[model samples]
Target: MLSSILTGIGEATQLSALVANLVGVIVGITFGSMPGLTFSTGLILLLPVTFAFDPVTGISLLVGVFIGGMTGGSVSAILLGIPGTPSAAATVIDGYPLKQKGMAGKALGMAVIASIFAGLVSLLLLILVAPLIAKVALQFGSVEIFALVLFGLSTIISVSSGSVIKGLIAGIIGLMAMEIGLDPVMGVHRFTLGYEPLQAGIDLLAAMIGLFAIPQIIKDLPRSQGETGIKIEEKGITNQLPSWQEIKSCFGIMVRGALMGTGIGSIPGTGGPIAAFLSYETNKRMSKHPEKWGTGILEGVAAPEAANNGVTGGALIPMLTLGIPGDPGTAILLGALLIHGLQPGPLLFQNNADVVYGIFAALFIANILTLIVQWFGIRLFVKILQVPKTILLPAIMVLTIVGSFAVRNNLFDVYVMAVFGVIGYFLERYDFPTTPVILAIVLGPTLETEMRRAIIAEGTYTAFFTHPISAVFIFLTLVMLFGPTVKDKIAARRAA
Candidate 1:
C-alpha cells in the first residue's frame, strides 16, 4: 500500500499534472464562488478540454476542481448570505449572523480550517476503507433512503429554534413550490397552471437565491444613511486562527461532521446538502447551548463546512469503486474518465492503480492549496461587506437576477425569483424562518420519490418499519422531532 501511494504521488507530481491540478482549482473556485454556477457546471464546461490530457493528469484536474469548488462556496454563503452552491446552504444558517456581528473573519477561518480538516479525513477514509464503506452503503434501499430524508426533515426543529410552527409552515410552502412541475412517478403535470416554463419545475438555485438573497437586499435598502449595516475596520480585519481551546472544543463536532458527510456522500443520489444539514443538526443537539446554534456560533460554521467538503471524497468512492456516480458532479467526472479511455470500477483499479492513486494524491494537494488560498485571500472576500448598501445591494440584485436566469437560460426563472423574493420578504417580516423552506425544497422530491418506490416494491408500507436501517432512521427522526419537548417536560417536573 505504501509503495502504491508513493508511486501515485510520484505520478501526480509531474509538471503537466501539477499545472492541470492548479488550473482546475482556480477555475473551480471561480465558478463555485459565483452564484448559480456550481462545481458540476464547471466540470461540464471543462470536459471538452480534458479530452487531450492523459488519464492520470485529467482525473487529477477534475479532482482538484471538485475540492476547490466545495471550499469556495462557503465564502459567499458566509459573507453575503447567498449560497454559491447548494452545498453551502447550511453554512448560511449561522455564517451570515457571524458576519453581521463583526466576526466574518472568524466564520471564514473556521470554514476554511474545517473544510481542510474534513477533506483530509474523508480522503484518508476513502483510501483506507472505501470498499468496506461502499459495501455497507450498497445495502441501503429505497425504504432506507426515504427514512433518511425524513430524518433530515426532522432536523427542521433544530434549525427553527424560536418558532417551530412557523418553520413547519415554511417547509410546507417550499414543498408546495417544488410540486409545480411534473409528478416524479406518474409524469403528470400537477400544478403548472398551464405555464410552459412551470412544466420544468421551479429551479432550486433560483428559488434559493430569491429566498435568501433578495430578503437581505430589501432589508438593507430601507436603512437610514446614518445607520450602520456592518461596521468594518481595516485594522480589525485579521485572519486570526481560533484559540486552542476553541479548536479543541470543536474537534469532536468536526469529526462527527466528517463521518456523516462521508457516509452520506458514498450513497449515490444523496449529496452534500443532506450531509450538511444532518451534521449541523447533530452538533446542535449535542451542544450544551443549543439555543446558540443559529446565532453565530463557531460550531455552526464548522459542522456544515466540514460535512460539505467531506462529501467530495465520499462521493468519489462509489464512482471509482463501483462505476456509479454518487452525485451529478461525479457523473460528470465519470464522463471525463470514460473520455480518457479509463472505465472506473474494480477492474479499472486493478489495471490502472496509478490513475486511482493519482486522483487521491491530487485531492490531498488541492485541499492544502485551498487552505492556503482561502486563508490569504479571505480579507479581500470580507471587504465586500464594507461596500455601501447603495452600491452593494444593487450589485447583489443584479447577480441574483442573472444567476436565476442562467440556470437554464429561461427568463421565467427570473420571474420565479421575483415571486419567491416577495414571499421571502413577507416571511421575514412575519418572523418566519426561511431555512426550513430551503430544506423542504431540497428534500421533498427525494422523500416523495423514494417513498413511492419503496411502497411499490414492498407492496405495503410495512417495509419502512420492518427494514432495520429504515426503522432505525424512522426512530431517529422521531427522536429528533420530539426529544426536545420530552426533555423540557422532564426539566419542568424536576423543578416542580
Candidate 2:
C-alpha cells in the first residue's frame, strides 16, 4: 500500500498531470461561478477534450474540476445572491445575507475555509473506506438499490423547506417527465406524444439549465435597469479570512456538515444539494440560537459550504468502487474514465493500482490548489456582481442555450430547455421550489428501473422488507420523510 501510494504520487506529479489539473480547476471555477453553467455542464463540455489523454492524467483533470466547481458556486451565491449551481442553493440562504451585512469577505472566507476542510476530511475518508464500501456494495441486489433510491428520495422533505405538498407535486412531475423516455422493463414508450425527440426524453442538461438557470434569467430581467440586480454594498471587503474566534465558534458546525456531506455523498443518486440542506438544517437545530439563523451567521455559511465541497470526495467513493455514479458530476466522471478505456470497480483498483492511487494524489493536490486559487481570485469574482444585470442576463441566457444544444447537438434539447424554463419560471412565481423537481428528475429513472427489477426478482413487493439492507434503507426512508414533522408536532403539543 505504501509503495502504491508513493508511485501514485510520482505519477500525479508529472508535468501533464499538474497542467491538466490546473486548467480543469480554472475552467470549472469559471463555469461554477457563472449562472446557468454547473460543474456537470462544464464536465460534459470538456468530455471530448479529455478523450485524447491517458487515464491517470484525464481523470486527474476531471477531479480537479469536480473540486473546484463545488467550491466556486459559493462565490456567486455569496456575491450575487444567485447560486451558480444547484449544489450551492443552500449557501445562498445565509451567504447572501452576510454579503448584505457588508461581510461579503468574511462570508466568502468562511465558505472557502469550510469547503477546504470538509473536502480534505471526505477525501481522506474516501481513501480509507471506499474499497471496503465497494465490497459491501457488491452485495446490493435490486431490492437494496430500490431501497437506496427511496432513501434518497426521502430528502425531499428537507429540500422542500416550505410546502411539502408543492415539493411532492414537483417531485411527481419530475418522475413523470422521466417516463417520457422508455419503459425500462417493457421497452414501451409511454409519454412521447408522438414526438421523436421525446423518445430520448428530456435531456438532463436541458432540464437542469431550464429549471435553475432560465428562471434566474427571467427574474433578473426586471432588475436589468438597476445598477445591480441585488442592492448589497461591497466596500471595505479587504481581509476576507475569518478571525480565530469566529473559526472556533464554527468548528463544530463545520465538522458536522462534513460528516453529513460525506455520508450522503457516498450514496448513489444523492448529491450535494441534499447534503447541503441537511447540514444547514441540522446546524440550525443544533445551534444555541436557532432564531438567529438566516440572519447572516458564519455558522450558516460554513455548514452548507462544508457539506457541498465534502460531497466532491464522497460522491467519488461509489463511482470509483461500484461503477455507480453518486451524482451527475460523477456520472460524467465515469464517462471520462470509460473514454480512456478504464472502468471503475474493484477489478480496476487491482489492475490499475497506479492510476487509482494517482487519482487520490491528484484530488489531494486539487483541493489544496482550490483553496489557493479561490483565495487569490475571489476579488475578481466579486467584481462580477458589479456587472450590469442586462448584460449579465443576456450573456447567461445565450450560454445556457448553447450548453443545452451542446450536450447532444440537438436543437430539440434547446427547445426542451426553453419549455422547462417557462415551467420553472411559473413554478418560482407560484412559490413552488424547483429543487425537488430537479431531484426527482435525477432519481426518477433509477427508482422506477430498480423497483421493477426488485419486483421481478422477488416475485412480490413484500420482498423489499425481507432483505436486511433493503429493510434498513426502507425504515430510514420512512423516518426521513415523516420524522421531522412528527417531532415538530410533538414539540408543538408540549408547548401548548
Candidate 3:
C-alpha cells in the first residue's frame, strides 16, 4: 500500500498532471461561476479535449474541473443569489443574504475554505475506505433508495422560509411539474397535453435558473433606472479570510457536512445537490441559533459548500471501484475513463494500481489548487456587486435566457424557464419558499421510480417497513416530518 501510494504520488507530480490540473481548475471556475453552466457541462465540453492526453493526465484535468466547479458555484450564489449549479442552491440561502449585508467577501471566503477542508476529508475517505463504502452502497436496493429520498423530501420543512403550508403547496406544484414528462416506470406520458416537447418534462437546470435568477433580475429591473450596484466594503474584500476563532466555531458543522456529503455521494444516482441540502438542513437542526440560519450566517455557507465539495471524492469511490457513476458528472468521468481504455472495476485496480493512486493524488492537488485560486479570486469576484444595475440586470437576463436554452439546446427549455421564472416571482412575492419546489423537482422522479420498483419487486407496500434500511429511513422521515411540531407542543405545555 505504501509503495502504491508512492507510485501514485510520482505519477501525479509529473508536469503534465500539474498543468492539466491547473488548466482544468481555471476553466472549471469560469464554467461554474456562470449561472446555468454546471460542472457536468464543463466536463462534457472538455472530454473531447482530454482525448489527446494520457489517461492519468486527462483524468487529472477532469478531476480538477470537478473540484473547481463544485466550489465555484458558490461564487454566483453569494454574489447574485443565483446558484450557478444545483449543488450551490443551499449556499444561496445564507450566502446571498451575506452579500446583501455587504459581506460577500466573507461568504465567498468561507465557501472556499469549507470546500477545501471537506474536499480533503472526502479524499481521505476515498483513499482509506473506498472498497468498504462501495460494498455497502451496493446493498441499497430500490426500497432503501425510496426511503432515503423520502427522508430527503422531508427537508422541505426546514428549507421553507416561513410557512410550512405554503412550502408543501410549492412542493406539490413541483411534483406535479415532474409528472408532466413520460412516467419513469412506464413509457406512457401523463401531462404532456399532446405537446411533444412536454414529454421531456421540465429541464431541472432551466427551471432552477428561472426560479432563482429570473426573479432577482425582474426585481432589479425597476431599480436599473437610478440605482448603482451594491456598495461592497473595502475592508471586506481585502480581509476576506475568516478568523481562526470563527473557523473553530464552524469546525463541527463542516465536519458533519463533509460526512453527510461523503455518505450521499457514495450512493449511485444521488448527487451533490442532495448532499448540499441535507447538510444545510442537518446543520440548521443542530445549531443552537437555528433561527439565524438563513440570515446570512457564515455557518450556513460553510455547511453546504463543504458538503458539495466533499461529494467530489465520495462520488469517485463508487465510480472507480464498482464501475458505477455516483452522479451525472462522474458518469461523464466514467465515460472518459472508458475512452482511455481504462475500465474502472476491480480488475483495473489490480492492473492499473498506479493510475488509481495517481487519480487520488490528483484530487488532493486539485483541492489545494482550488483553495489558492478561489482565495485570491475572491477580491475579483466581489467586483460583480459593483457593476451598475442598468448594465448588470440586462446582462444577467441575457445569460439566463441563453443558459436556459443551452441546457438541452432546446428553445422549449427557454420557454419553460420563462414560465418557472414567473411562478418563482409570484411565489417569492407571496412569501412562499421556492427551495421546496426545487427539492421536489429534484427528488420527485427518484421517489416515483423507486416506490414503483419496490412495489413491483415485493408486491406490497409493507416491504418498505420490512427491510431494515428502508424502515430506518422511513422512521427518520417520520421524525423529520413531525419533530418540530412535537417540540413546539412540548414547549407550550411546559410554559402553561
Candidate 4:
C-alpha cells in the first residue's frame, strides 16, 4: 500500500499531469461560473479528449475539473445572485446580500477559504474510508454484487427531485436502450430492430454528451446577450480578504458542513445541491443569530461553500470503490474510467492499486491548486460570465457532435447523439429527471450480468436472500424504494 501510494504520488507530479490539472481547473472554473454551463457538461464535452491520454493523466484532469467547478459556482452566486450551478443555490442567499453590502471581496475570499478547508477534509475522509470499503467489498460474490447494484438503482428515488414515477420511467427507458445490443452472456441479439449499429448498443460517451449537453444548449441559445446586465463594481471588490477573526469564527461551521457534505455525497444520487442546502439550513438552525443568516453573514457563505466543495471528494468515494456514481458528474467520470478500460470495484484496487492511489494524489493536488488559483485569479474567472451564449452554445454543440463521433469514429454514433438530444430536451421540458436514465445506462449491464451469474452459481433465486451481505443490501433496496411512501401514508393517517 505504501509503495502504491508512493508510485501514485510520482505519477501525479509528472509535468504532463501538472499541466492537465492546471488547464482542467481553469476550464472547470469557466464552466461553473457561467450560468447554464455545468461542470457535468464540461466533463461530457471533454470526455473524448481524455481517451487519448494515459489513465492517470486523464483521470487527473477530470478530478481537477471536478474540484475547481465545485468551488467556482460561488462566483456568480455572489456577484449576480444567480447560482452558476444548482449546488451554489444556497450560496446566493447570503452571497448576494454580501455583494449588495459592498462586501463582495470579503464574501468571495471566505467562500474560497471555506471551500478549500472542506475539500481537504473530505479528501482525508475519502482516503481513509474508501480502501476499507473496498476491502470489505472484495469478499462480495455475484449474488452480493447483484444486490448492491439493486441498491444503487433504488437511489433513483433520491435524484427524482419532483416525481419518482417519472424517474423510474426514465430509468426503464435507459434499461431498454441497453437491451438493444447483443446480450452480454448469451451473445444473442435482443432488440437490434434490424440495424447493424444497434447490435452494438448505444455508445455511453455519445449518450452522455447528448443527454447532458444538448438540452443545456437548446435552453440557453435563445438568450443573445450574456453577462451584459450584471455589473461588477471595482472599488469594494479588490483585496477584500476576510479577517483572521472571521475565519476563526466560522471554523466550526465549516467543519460541520464538510462532514455533512461528505456523508450526503457518499450516498448515491444525493449530490452537491442537497448537501449544500442541508448544510446551510442546519447551520442556520444552529446559529445563535438565525435572523442574520440570510441577511449576509460569513457563516452563510461558509456553510454552503464548504459543503458543496466538500462534495467533490465525497462523491468520488462510491464511484471509485463501488462502481456506483453518487451524482451526474461522477457518472460521467465513471464512463470515462470504463472508456479507458478501468473497471471500478474492489478488484480494481487489488489489480490497479497504482492507478487508484494516483487518483488520490491527483485529487489532493487539485484541491491545493484550486485554492491558489481561485484566490489569485478571481478577476479572470469572473470575466468568463461575459461570454455570449450565442457563441458559446454553438461551439459546445460542435464539441458534442465531435465528441460523440470520435468515440468509435462512426457517423452512426453522431446520429444517435442527435436523437438522444431531442429525447433529453423533451424529458427536461416535462420536468422529468434525466439522472436516473444516465445511472441506468451505466449500471444496467452490470445488474443484468450479475443477476444471471448469481442465479447460475446458486441454481435458485433464493441465493440472493440467503447470503448475509446480499440480504442486507436487498433489504436496504426495499427500504429505499418504499420507505418514503409508507412514511407519507402513516403521516396522512395521523393527520386524518
Give the candidate number with the greatest lDDT. 4
Off by over 4 Å in 3: 1-119, 126-131, 222-224, 232-366
What are the runs in model 1 whose C-alpha is more than 4 Å off? Answer: 1-119, 122-132, 226-366, 378-385
Better of 2 and 3 by TM-score: 2
Residue-level lDDT of model 3, residues 1-496, one tens digit each, is 5687788888788999899998889767766876655666566556556656888898889988999999999988988788978899999999999988988888888999999999999999998887565456557788987887787677677667499899889989888888888988889989898999999888776776677677777665754456565564546554388889989999999999898898888765467899999999999999999999999999999999999988888888867875655455775677677657787655456678888889999999999998898887666655643555677557667777776776567899889988999999999999998767776776677789989999999999899999999999899878877888999999999999
The TM-score leader among the candidates is 4
Query: Candidates ranked by TM-score, best first?
Result: 4, 2, 3, 1
Residue-by-residue lDDT tens digits, candidate 1, 1-496: 5676678888888888888888788767765765555766566445545656777777777877898889889978887788878889999999989888888788888998999999999999899876564456556788977887787676677657578889889889988998889999999998988878889898776677677677767775744566544444455456768878888889999999998999888766577899999999999999999999998988999999999988988888877775655455775676577657776655566667777788888989889878877788767645544445576457667777776776667788889988999999999999998767876776678779989999999999799999999999899888877888999999999999
lDDT of 4: 0.89
Candidate 2 residue 477 C-alpha distance from true site, Å: 1.7
Collision pairs in model 3: none
- For each candidate, what is the lDDT? 0.79, 0.81, 0.81, 0.89
After aligning candidate 4 to the native by TM-score, how far in Å is the CA of 125 from where it should be?
Answer: 0.6
Candidate 1 lDDT for residue 147: 86
Model 2: per-residue Cα lDDT over 156-238, one tens digit each: 76667679888888889888888887788898888887777788778776777778778777775664344554343547565
Q: For candidate 1, give the lDDT.
A: 0.79
Query: Over 4 Å off in model 4, which ranges?
Result: 223-235
List CA RMSD, all candidates.
Answer: 9.0, 5.4, 8.2, 1.6
Worst 10 residues of 4 by lDDT: 223-232
